[model samples]
Target: MQFREIIRQALYSLGANRLRSALTVMGVAVGVFSIIGVMTALEAVNKSVETGLTSLGANTFQIQKYPATVFGSGHRRNQYINRQDITYPQALVFRKTMEGKASTIGFMLSSQANQAKYADRTTNPDVVLTGGDENFSASNGYPIEKGRNLTTNDIRYATNAAVIGSELAATLFTQGENPLNHSIRVGGEVYRVSGIFAKKGAAFGQSQDNFLLIPITRYLNHVKESGSINITVEASSRKTYSRTLDHAVGSMRITRGLTIREPNDFEIRTNESLIDSFRDIERAISTGAFIISFMALLTAGVGIMNIMLVSVTERTKEIGIRKSIGAPQNSILRQFLLEALILSLAGGLIGAAAGTATGNLVALQFNLPPIFPLLWITISMAVCSAIGIGFGLFPAWKAANLNPVEALKGK
Candidate 1:
């Protein structure tokens, strides 16, 4: 039989056993769905993060007591916990030391779930309150939309001045109301609104403009005294950025009182490092998804093999009659193999579509754009085709090698 004729015969056979074919196709679909769904969601989140990180500006890095992301356990986890807090005094000293080497060095800290109130209207307790120095806005890419930024004097005096984000501004003041020079209650303390930040849209479903900012000194004194602070540093020039990172590392070690032989106790995070961390997480998730999909496909492959074996048995008389006439062994083999390919390829197409849709739904919840994973679709179809060949070969060979007289006599 010709290849097209073989495929046509295969389809007819599959159509004859509709329920069995559906069940077999379902197994392959499930396997494809597991991996494709996970990968699509991960890709969407990664894209969102990349865009958000780019808005943090260029040649900037941050220092903190602990790494932004932690992996591993036991001694490594405890080591990070045991590190001393990056004190306000230490931050001030570092700022003084790096005066000529860095463009802007800002100290910052934050408290979440604090309420902000203007007269009778109060925002939800989920509001975030941040404390930073004069250069905080410049270092953090927060452009002042109205009024002026906090002055050095504010940090020095630990003044009750505040800069609110655009979202917060809208919440606190009426449409035409100028928030500058107005007092609003944040965490039960009244602070004069010194400036309002430009609107920054949401990332990962969380609003970037939902927080209020105050002087870092005021934050440390009133919000929480003994906690660690994050220090932001911008390089003086792009040419010196790498050297600046090395200089900052050495300076931080000195500030923290670490000896030559002692290991440094803080983490330095740059835009590149943050991206690398996220990629590492993505790899881990991808690995897990691969494993789960492997198992599911393996089971599906077995099901295909079992169903093919049954098909060979049920069509014994037909096979014998064809062989008794002019049908060749390879023709019979091609027919069975074509049937398996049809089932697997159909399942792969369905599963890829379903998985992409499901993953986009998850991405939508996080306010990320929908993504169609073309690479995964190609890979799934290729893998499904391989599964077809791997599992179908034996049964096809069995059907082809059967004794025509014996098969016909079996009734």
Candidate 2:
């Protein structure tokens, strides 16, 4: 049969059952919409998360008590006792042991949205308060822009000195008069601004430049309840990362008193490990999306089959009349198959458009760049069309094979 005849038959059949065809098309559209929308949103957020994880320099690794990504709260607290602190002493041991292999820097951050006062000047509470020991600058890439980095002497004597990030400096001090000698009150104690940090821009939607770095010793004294004292280890190079990590873990396991067979209680986090965690989350989301979308598609496929069967039944006498007039069996089958394809393709286009819009809308709200899952959209539409053909086959074939006599008798 010619292409024009096939199309004519498709349009006539679909238009003849206008409301039913629309409802069936809506079902397919919903399926594609669910999966495509989710994929786009996730791609945008995943990009943001990856940028955030690698915000710290590539060579850096951190040792702490908890995993980098904490899911649904209170579970960690309830399941484990002895919420150990990676003590200052333990970190010192790690530093001494790692020696030439990796550069170890000890830090402990205590963040509070506390008021900052400088005479009549009041700063916002959202400012980050980071506390680092002597090696903070080298290991974490926080180079000093003005005054010297914190020294062992500073931590030893619990010095009342602080370093401001570039953004925080701008907010507090005016006209580039140097914030180095100025004093700011934090938690009711006056701390002299000893240095200013160069701007590092935003990391994972949070401003990295909006922070203050003070001696870790002073932080421990002031914010007595800081959870885990983190030890950051910068591996010698990317090539040596695995060995460096293994060496750190082995040494830490020995120092922290874990037996050969025992698993270490502490967690070592790196950008790659953080990515693995995100992968787990992404997998879960993808699985849920597949299940939901598949159910919708399955319903649509059943609806297509039902509609195809009804079309075959209603056109019984037409099939008999066509067969008597020498219409080939393959042509009859082609007509039904083409009709189903047109329905699926129509729904797929509308669904792809809707999904893209919804996904981009969500990304915009989260301050993330919009994403188009073009590959997924293409594959999904193709799959929907394939489903229509596959499911409509039996009914189409049955209609093609119907006995002309019985069909003409209106059975």
Top lDDT hit? 1
The sequence of per-residue lDDT tens digits that candidate 1 reaches over residues 71-179 is: 9978889999998999989998888778788888887898888889997888888888998999889888889999889998998999999999999989888999898
C-alpha lDDT score of every prediction, in listed order = 0.89, 0.82
With a 3 Å backbone cut-off (N, CA, C), the pairs that clash in candidate 2 are none
List the candidates' TM-scores in order.
Answer: 0.91, 0.80
Off by over 4 Å in 2: 16-18, 70-81, 112-126, 143-153, 166-194, 201-205, 239-243, 259-262, 315-332, 357-368, 401-410
**Candidate 2 lDDT by residue in tens digits, 341-394:** 888878788888898889888677556766888899989988988988988898
Candidate 2 backbone clash number: 0
Which candidate number maximizes TM-score? 1
